[model samples]
Target: MHQLLSRTFKPTFLKIYNESHLHNQKLGRETHFRVVIVSHEFNTISPVKRERLVHKSLEHELQAGVHALSVIARAVDEPLDTHTSPPCQKPVV
Candidate 1:
């Protein structure tokens, strides 16, 4: 996933967190993710457009059972938010 996003975005800074453990799904499943992407490509784009671009780039993964994705896309000049996803309320089995 990280490689794919890197190829697609060419971001200056990128972080991909696999939050699958925070879910109740089967162990080792790569279902949930949070990605922070900083790239010049996003400079003049609207927030919705940035998200759409990221989503479009990961279309294949989403189809292959990526259940949830949280994205924070920013231009190179924008401030980054490093926070990750909230803890899951559901108990892991």
Candidate 2:
């Protein structure tokens, strides 16, 4: 996933936070992610378009096993948020 994003987005800053353990699941399982991407590629795009671009890059993982995914895609000059994320709604197994 990281490699894919790197190749596709060419972000100046990339952060992939694995939040799978915080969900309702067994320990050490990786199914959810919080990604912070800063890229010049996003400079001319809207927020929705940024999400679409990211989803397009990770389509197969979302279909295969990833239960929840959240992203903060920003342009190189944009500011990042420092607030906390809400609870995950992971599926019941």
State which candidate has the highest TM-score: 1
lDDT of 1 by residue, 3-45 (tens): 9889988999999888898887777889999989999999999
Q: Name model 1 segments beyond 4 Å from true.
A: 91-93
Clashing pairs in 2: none
TM per candidate comes to: 0.89, 0.89
- Model 2 weakest lDDT span, ten residues long: 82-91
Clashes of 1: 0
TM-score of 2: 0.89
Which 10-residue window of candidate 1 scores lowest in summed lDDT? 83-92
lDDT of 2 by residue, 1-89 (tens): 99999999999989888888788768888898888899999999998999889988999999999987898999988898734568866
